[model samples]
Target chain A: MSHPTSTTNKTLAHPLNAWYVAGWDYELTRKPLARTIANRPLALFRTEDGRPVALADACWHRLAPLSMGKTLGRDEIQCPYHGITYNSAGRCTSMPAQETINPSATVPSFPIVDRYRFAWVWLGDPEKADPALIPDMHQMSSPEWAGDGETIYAPCNYQLVLDNLMDLTHEEFVHASSIGQEELSASDFKVTHDDRTVTVARWMFDIEAPPFWLKNMRDKFPGFEGRVDRWQIIHFEAPSTIRIDVGVAKAGTGAADGDRSQGVNGYVMNTISPETDKTCHYFWAFMRNYCLDSQLITTQLRNGVHGVFGEDEAMLKAQQEAIDANPDYEFYSLNIDAGGMWVRRLIERMLEAEGRLAATQEPQPARVGA
Target chain B: MAANSSTVWQRGRVVELRDVARDIRRVVIEPESPVRAAPGTHVDIAVVVNGEQDVRSYSVVESDDDGTRLALSVFRTPTSRGGSVFMHGLGEGAEVELTQPLQNFPLRVGAARYIILAGGIGVTAVLGMARVLARLGADYRFVYAGRSREAMAYLDELIDEHGDRIEVHVDAEGTPLDVPSLVGGLGRDTELYMCGPIRLMDAVRRAWQDFGLDLPNLRYETFGNSGWFDPEEFVVRIPRLGLETVVPKDRSMLEALEAAGADPMFDCRKGECGLCEVEVLELTGDIDHRDVFYSQRQQEASAKMCCCVSRVVTPAATGSRERKPVISIELS
Candidate 1:
């Protein structure tokens, strides 16, 4: 199979017509919050009625960032530079100094919805926005699961982060002190895909528990001295949602089958939204089914995952810097990049299809003589 | 009568087909060209059934903006005449004709709250509405009912996606829907939309009226050719074509015209698309407005009617009546 060389290019465009996590629900308050996605600045906040809204951060008049402004009434955002107040739909509602406000005076508003404790924004045509495409991360909010989440700004390209998550072999060397184990790199794995999703699954039979798992599972299972069944299932939902299901169970407990109750199950939701060419917003949560009400386990898992991500951040940032220094060099893909490569191909196909549509939809030029 | 002049037909290829439920097949198609469709809209698919071109409407389960792909979940009922069976018999890579998405049962955004009622395969019609409402952060509840869990399409997916917001009632499971209680418990300023079998819709309509809810807020769309009046044979006169045809109780006006060799441009025989509409020059009886395409005022005026679904009803035969309702119309 032939691979597109452009996939390795650093200037690849991010797919826009898809839902991306802007921030957690708790992060947005009455105050405007600024975030950059796909190199576009966005101002996000909730109205008095608790409806989340996102708009272009730049004012339509003087190009001042709206995140620096204050909210007026129940749903209008007032620009600090000119006192131009806009409603939740991004239409300019009032202008303090002008006698007649221009009807065209408005900023681009994005389609936003709150679900699973996260505010998701559609950075595409509002008319075509469909919430069904949003990845199912309900486990984070379900009563049967307990977990904590965190958002970190990584100084690296979003694709680098995706690549890192898609291939967990690095964990053996990078996260050896915590959740890493040799079985992760040594075990055989399989890659599968449907029309809209890609999954990478790996199972290590009768393997020793890693440090983090041992620390958490020792209390739950006191007789956990022998080998156990461990599995890692990573799912990539287009365009940029990654969920990793990692857990272990007693030897020969049928955990590999549909019976997950025989094992301890936890989910790692890693949602990547591009901030710019060299930065991204990483919203992540760790949910476990075994300890639904244990605050201690939640905190421990949160800190442990946070530290593990920090190690990835350091490595990715350094990698980005090196790639920047050698801008003309093209990166090569390995056998383990199958999952990440599939995601890249899907994004490219969508982008190409959109481009073709726009080309055809462009107004035809009038006949020269007619 | 002249055929509908505004219908735009496009070619689509069936790419995938899988049974999601006992008799429900999730059909995914790739159109010849990309077409954009909003949530709560449907497209008319044209299939050759028994050596004749037949058109039927199916709700769009999902579609992208570029329209590169469209997905529809269709259920084959035992009472189905031929449309559902013809669609089910289609294999992968079979190219068929379809019209652009048409919106007859549109979701009215900005309501204080939304209540969606879906019965059996009718869930396909309101599934997109729920998705859009969820994305808008609007308060909404989805109540879906069917004979059994095994016969319901998208039940598992809907529950997985919407969680507590969805309430599923399976009759075989002893969970029957309480229409009165459900309608009575609705909050003020809420709008209710339903799409289902005639019985379910009629029950909801009656309960809604009993509860004193705003009649305009209770919107609905029927499956196919379903109406309150029992099917009866009638005669249609086309002044321009100088043709008169007898529409049998089992056939629609459009079908009768086609059988009489009078071409009628039409799409979405389900009565959603305004194509195949005809101007009513004279009417000798009351009209049964089965189609949801026309407003109440338009239906009352009796000026025009969608030939695909709407029909005329003569005054009840009284004192040995032998003549049927005669509707003189011209193709619009």
Candidate 2:
């Protein structure tokens, strides 16, 4: 391997075989919504019967963007240009001036499933699009947890977001005013990975809780004033999804041994979808097991995480700009990169299986006529 | 450039060495720190040749998951400056200095399809890439070309691993590789990566152009030492610095200049990065543009040369130690 000093990690392509959230369930409805997942433009909408549908945004007739068109009848979209209509399955339903419809007048219909409050779309092989493979975001809809989240249209590669989530040490610096703490940088962590998942577990015992965690702890255990046991267990699912188990409890309550009854536990659910080579749709939620009925806590937690992640968003954007400037610089990994490395290895495997990955990620411009 | 002026070299020791094929030896080294190498990664090793330390680059043929161990295959070329000979002479437990594995030839993940072509010793470059694709169940074709069956290293292993996806073209069989046929068979979406002799690379490039394939889709890594002309003694003079040095047949111009205390900016000594490039002020002989850093048009213009792997050659000199062609250049 020749490490070029000027290489950028932004050129890594996204894997398409996995399902990515196209939009929140509420975001897709009678009116068609335009979205790009894994570089494939799509028109997302719901049929009159309330079934989620995703179709290639381009119309079959003149390649017009169907997303600009209006919904009509039961489950069809009328192309804004030339009155072409396509059903939810992307089959041309009717032609304005022609009697016989060309059998080939059909757009690609992606397999879309509505689950966990999201419209998940698969842009790769339709046959392999299995809903079971969707990452486990049960916390989003489960009765045991209550929370809210917002979407961040991050202006950086999806992998960068995943790396941010996989390693929490960055929080110490990037979110110094909120969740950042010296214990985070001083603590040792463990990283483990399998074929489809990676887990990074870190624990800080008998340490002062960070401001964000302190507020959450007070919400559960009022007037708590002693050292606490804090933990951040990052779980990564292949392609791009991460669920971070986080919270703090009283120092000597046996929380480390799975008795979380003395702790305030929260799940930071994140799933990123690449919209292009350098941008992504970051969908994240902060679910808490202790406050299952309080709407106030849900909004407050969402707003707090939002602010913490805003810091990350700024850093990610700056990192991306630096990468763009030095297009040939390669990244140097530290000891903390174990979990992120596994994530990249898994992604590289998926890309290789799709025959889209080379051993080296050299950013070659799209050649003319290619 | 100043940040990269100083390189950090770590101590390593040879753990094992064995002949894998004709003139090809596989040497395994354990560096002080664990090394994880991606496919198409190579390392720069400081080899002591004739009591003087010189740097040489070699691709990592394989590595364990933990990266504590790495294996590199070297072909002993009688004309090689010194890297291969020094490596061939090393015994188990021999101490050496090497840089961390670096990747200049990374395989971009996520293409529609791929065709991996390797020629003779060039197999060392793409072997890891082939294994990765095979492990991932990617849609790919592996083509290996060699002068004879015995000369092809890891032939049996590749055939066993890739099964029918492996295609071998042994020149001894009197049926050489057909570049046009190969290029014609490629799908428009297929990316082809090749590493081989200069003749083979030239044929492939010509065929790719004739077929009107995508230029960027045809990626390749060239041997820095294999040029249009054989190695010969050359004289390099920098008028601005009042420096003149003789680059012997066994030494590269970059190394010779550095030995003479001429500070030059260089990275990826394999002629991939144009950093070590110098402006051709004057030439008393023809320049062999061996580096892949320049385009064919740039090489033909005769305005510069990558001193790391390129040199000046006299038209009438062949195996003549007395012939020293002088080339005046300005460090860029």
Candidate 3:
């Protein structure tokens, strides 16, 4: 018999208290862009002075979408249905029907911060919104790091994408031709977590570089060829952000000991924002410490990561479909799920703090015979 | 969804066992796999109580960064439902069934300032969290209270590690905790995380409300075994299951039902989760609710009870002395 209860559901509710990236800094311009985060629709735009702002997408008058309307003076947006105009704070400044605006004729203006080349919006209580709580994605804006990235409209829950990045063993099966190597599953990893972060670090010694790493190595050192030491250190910050530090060094270098002078290092920056229960807006970038001035290398690496992540997109879509089909079945986890489990636990805590947790228990590791 | 992998009960060996306080035992368990435990992590042990296997949860006191080893201290409650008694009897090399480290009371990072309060045995649940905040160089204070100095576990160790950041209060020393002043003095940005006896938690809760502090800023973990009234033997009759059993003072209603072959759904087993709640069709005695899951209004209604930790307490002189307190429930 199948039993469906709140405690066994696979889909998790999002935490509104945390910050989720709405779009790239360039995407939010004078024109308003409609985006949803944590199930709340927001109209994102920039002020004339180049400061980002996020307001409720629904107009206070007649509930018309404000994003469909055009910008008026400075930072004001006009309602598409009527001529009502709202300022950056979502307060109605002009009403065509009357001289005096209604005191309650105001939409919610969320607190937004433009940092690390992304516009992050807080969809919860404005009083508790703190910019310091934004996940650290320093590589995106650092002058020492150079790269570019794109957005993936993933057809899966944000947690699925988080699980995919927390464990890289699946790369051996999903992206075998690009970054996969048999040594990945064979290597032992150490998983550590604090209140807000979970880290999984793995290193492979004296192994042949995967095709993706080999190509990147040759870009920095034209004729680089040899067995190399590879490392994948994944750091996950609460809600939905993961930054992976990856690279390969010459076999005998002391890369594992914090000396990576003879290595080519790159960081895969990812922050996913939930648009709804079954969809997410995935913003990612591929940044590298080396080749800071090489536009050719930057474009190549971006495209390379794009191709690699496409495979994950397909797999995650299929996984979500399977989950929907078998709503009575719960996911089973293995040793590889240690990091992902911590990520889920952290998100669960956030949801509980927001009074949204409904007894949903993420699957634990499979039971072994006693 | 069906219950699949909420927990993986595995066999673990009691590698070390020692007395940490006057009535507390510190146990070290070595599982087959490494368990990386963060702050507020706990483990569920399948202990044999009343000759039947039952699950009990205890907060982790300490753990290695690599999770190769885990330590927990259990208070030898004189009024326990036998979980603590079974734990106190465990010797080195004993095999026990245990779940991996599970966290429900996670410490939210990035708070402006933190104040961690522990009352008596509640210290076990908040010790790791205080340590993490201290290590991060964050602004925090640790307030620990016990009935006496000798009964406090890890008192010297905590003082040595945290130094001036630690504050000690002993009721026997006439330094009882002042919840009203503590709650009233909290700053607007301070987050208070506490774990302790129900009365202590209740006092803090009432004081926090009176001061009109942010509700979300006050987080706590319930000592599941502690409640408002002393446990008494009662009769639980489930009509649909056609089961009737006597819940002894040393056992919980959920344990009694499971022992009678009536499987009941439960998670956390600490009464925080409402999965094990059953509708109360009728009652012949007052319900001693020990769960934080329900609100004051809901508990006052007496329409439902959490089977994991709640029970009925009959008046001493009501009806015949031989007649036990009975509660009829509807279980789906």
Candidate 4:
């Protein structure tokens, strides 16, 4: 193991206490769902609901990806290339032809967990993974009036959004519509950084002032007259989960269902996951808690968020392209860039803490293909 | 037991089945698993007329895979479902089991020019050797003799598959066999593998002696089964374990050992199956060699298969009084 000099080389392979957003809960089912973390392809599907299972993707027989295979009625995955099937724990189930055989014919599988509506994969030291240590999501469970939400996939690194979300000032300049116009008062928001998580809070008012969708009760919504009454709370738990608050009406009141998008309305909560350093998966769900017709709310929320995600796609793609073109380029900063600096520093510190993992995870010599 | 009892595993459909003769069928066991019996190597085949393990061995004639299909020609007998019967009854698209490759008889190695004599289905195993000779561009002559031209299972097949490499001889002219001419002036590195009924093989076997011909080799595969093992009741002492047990004729030496509380490990069961091997502390009987294990010298010492095939000699049966102390037969 060599000493890691910087945080840029850190990956999900490292064993860290930092939070990692595995995937949407729905991604796991009785079937096998394959995902790659830190370039290591893995199959992670729940044999049953409410579980996050992971296993090495390749079969021992022919090195075929079990992820590409399917499940038989025995809760075993049949290798698509051959008829060899393996069970959940990765044991060879049937040889299809032999009545009896030598006893060394099985594949390998991994340990897993299902928690907080997200398929949380243990992207760290599996032996040390204590389910109690996973981040608790009390916010999602509270019976608060919230809007319905949707999920979207982004073709950019998840860290980009972490950086994007942590740096609160990107909204005013990048997003000219909706809540992006909220101005950050010079010193209104206080910032706090902890060893495992970070939080940022500030106040902004007159958010429904212009180009805003709420036209019916624009005057009726609270804090519509003040220039800075909107209190924005931002939280960035590492790996890739960011939460924020955009002060708005309680769910269900005509405000939550206000005809805002084009002519429709909804609320959104976005989650960003790194499909890879070059591609990211985004999931945003609409929290339509108070909506009278929940099904209709779910549909509207999916469509509206999908459209906005389409817009985000165009911008992120361009951003990734520009980054690729200018890989060696650097950026400057000023005092107003406090949010970006804080998040970056937090990442650097956390990565530095995982020095052991990074050191031992050096790449080995490439195997010659037979 | 039913004739079709030895087959253990198979999943491919039969591509074609031809009753090339009254007692022979050319079965094409295609792309299921690979059948790897060499030119003279044999395999145990199980044909399930009902549900039982009645087995018989057959020599593999060919092995090839072209991505499209594989083919095997077997001669099934109406009286014998084990090999000939199974193959004869197998229809196109019918499933069949070809046990793991068994090398009951390996090809005589290091022979350059050779004479291969076949009688009936005995030619099946020798076909592979002929094919190998052709592939390697080696010099070899084949004399394939059977009842008749059309009645021969692969008579035309050998002609179509290997041209100019074989000489077809049938017993249709009401003439005696020409053993002298066939065995004359054979090359130095040449050998003879005569496979057929006992009489033909014995005749071929004696031709070398009669002609006083010094040939490279002469080998044969006989229609061997049933009495390959004889059952008898007796007692054997193990000097190694210092114990004596009842030896039952119906039970194999391996079964006798375990029945009397001795431990053993094994694999295949046929005498050809090399599992229940035991060391001979001492013995007395003509070591009838049916097993595929051990060498000539070992069998000469009366040391061999105690599991399926072996006999014991008593003190009065043998003249020796002062036997080797602590005489025993331990696990092999």
Clash count, predicted structure 4: 34
User: What shift in Å separates residue B69 of candidate 4 from its native position after superposition?
Assistant: 61
TM-score for predicted model 4 compared with the true structure: 0.45
CAPRI quality level assigned to candidate 1 from its DockQ score:
incorrect
CAPRI-style class, candidate 4: incorrect
Q: 1 or 2, which is superior by lDDT?
A: 2
Candidate 1 per-residue C-alpha lDDT over B76-103 given as tens digits, one digit per residue, 9 for 90 to 100: 9798868899889989999989877767
Per-residue lDDT of model 4, residues B1-332, tens digit only: 11124444555567876666666666666646665445676556666654565666666566553322444556655455454555566777877665655554545322345777887777777877777666645567788887777667777778887788778777785543576677766643356877777787777667777776442256665444344334445666666677788765566666677777777666544444345767775654434455434344555665545355444533344545353222257775
Worst 10 residues of 4 chain B by lDDT: B1-10
Q: Is candidate 1 or candidate 3 better by TM-score?
A: 1
Each model's Cα RMSD:
15.5, 18.9, 16.7, 25.4
lDDT of 3 by residue, B211-293 (tens): 98755568785323377778889999988878899999988888898998888888656565577888999888889888766
Lowest-scoring 10 consecutive residues by lDDT in candidate 3 chain B?
Answer: B1-10
True contacts kept of each: 0.03, 0.00, 0.00, 0.00
Of candidates 4 and 3, the better by TM-score: 3
Which stretches in model 2 have alpha-carbon errors above 4 Å?
A1-11, A363-370, B1-332
User: Quick one: best lDDT, which candidate?
Assistant: 3
* Higher-ranked by lDDT: 2 or 3: 3
Task: Name model 3 segments beyond 4 Å from true.
Answer: A1-9, A359-370, B1-332
Compared with the true structure, the alpha-carbon lDDT of candidate 1 equals 0.80
Q: What is the C-alpha lDDT of each candidate?
A: 0.80, 0.84, 0.85, 0.57
